[model samples]
Target: MPSVEAGTAGPLTALSPIRLEFAQKAFIVSGGRLLLVRKSASDPFHPGRWEVPGGRLEVEDDLDLDDHIRREVWEEVGLKIDPGPPFHLWQWFMPDRADLAGRGQVRVVATARRCRPVTVDATLENQESDDHLDGCAWVPLDEAGTYDLIPSLRPVMRAFLLAAG
Candidate 1:
């Protein structure tokens, strides 16, 4: 994965290559812990590893970026989100790993937000439950590294936690 320096200059102006694509994501943080989902082992791209729940932007979504993120959050984690604008845009470089499967290496340009928390109920659970994840959890940012995480998301979680502060 590409490691761009993230301090004073921020991420976009950091050492990024030209091949990045914008993928909207929700940080989904609450009480110092963030929500993450582990994709099914059978799927491609960091399958069976923990990462923030999100996906590519769809064309007919018709909503603005914030609405897109709010929708994506519900779709992935079954939780309602109150987005606090965009905190940061992070560039993640995915490498070819065992779990990466048939997906090609690419840059994941992500825009993030801090979301309001809510309880996840059975209805919400059923709506958002996906085959990609074997399980999901809310882990503290510091402790999240210990989980089996997608290689590219490690820095993203860190970057947002720091940015949120």
Candidate 2:
């Protein structure tokens, strides 16, 4: 995957500038843990940051936002979400460039139930670099903030608190 230079620049531009586009993905939860990726202790996106599992929209995974979220959970986290009418908890928009060139947004969604955990092939989740992930584990929700996270993701953390209520 091509790494975008960090910024709020609308859209991942390439064929030349002047494109203002954005795609959506989410931070999903199940079994009291929010699935996360550790960016190889060497990636630029978060470089060792603990992040909600998700990625960009692709033509192949044709579905609405909710289905897209469900698909991403399986693809990135190795688990399937229950019959969920998943709702958006919060959205993190990339910082704007001039400072926005490399900017993107992530939406975090909390699911109601955790699926049966199954042994998964780690190779499937390798979106960018397999080295990016040190390991996968079910981490507690409260412990989320204990790890490095993008600024936009902060508010989504509150959803954990609400879910516990």
Global lDDT scores for all candidate models: 0.65, 0.50
Worst 10 residues of 1 by lDDT: 121-130
lDDT of 1 by residue, 1-165 (tens): 466564655555544333444677666766778787777777566677877766656557637776777677676667777777666676766653433344545566777666666654312253343436666787887776578767767676677766656
Alpha-carbon RMSD of each model: 9.7, 9.5
Candidate 2 lDDT over residue span 24-73, tens digit each: 43444556666656656666456666656555445566466556655665
lDDT of 2: 0.50
Best by TM-score: 1
Model 1 TM-score relative to the real fold: 0.66
**Structural similarity to truth (TM-score) of each candidate:** 0.66, 0.56
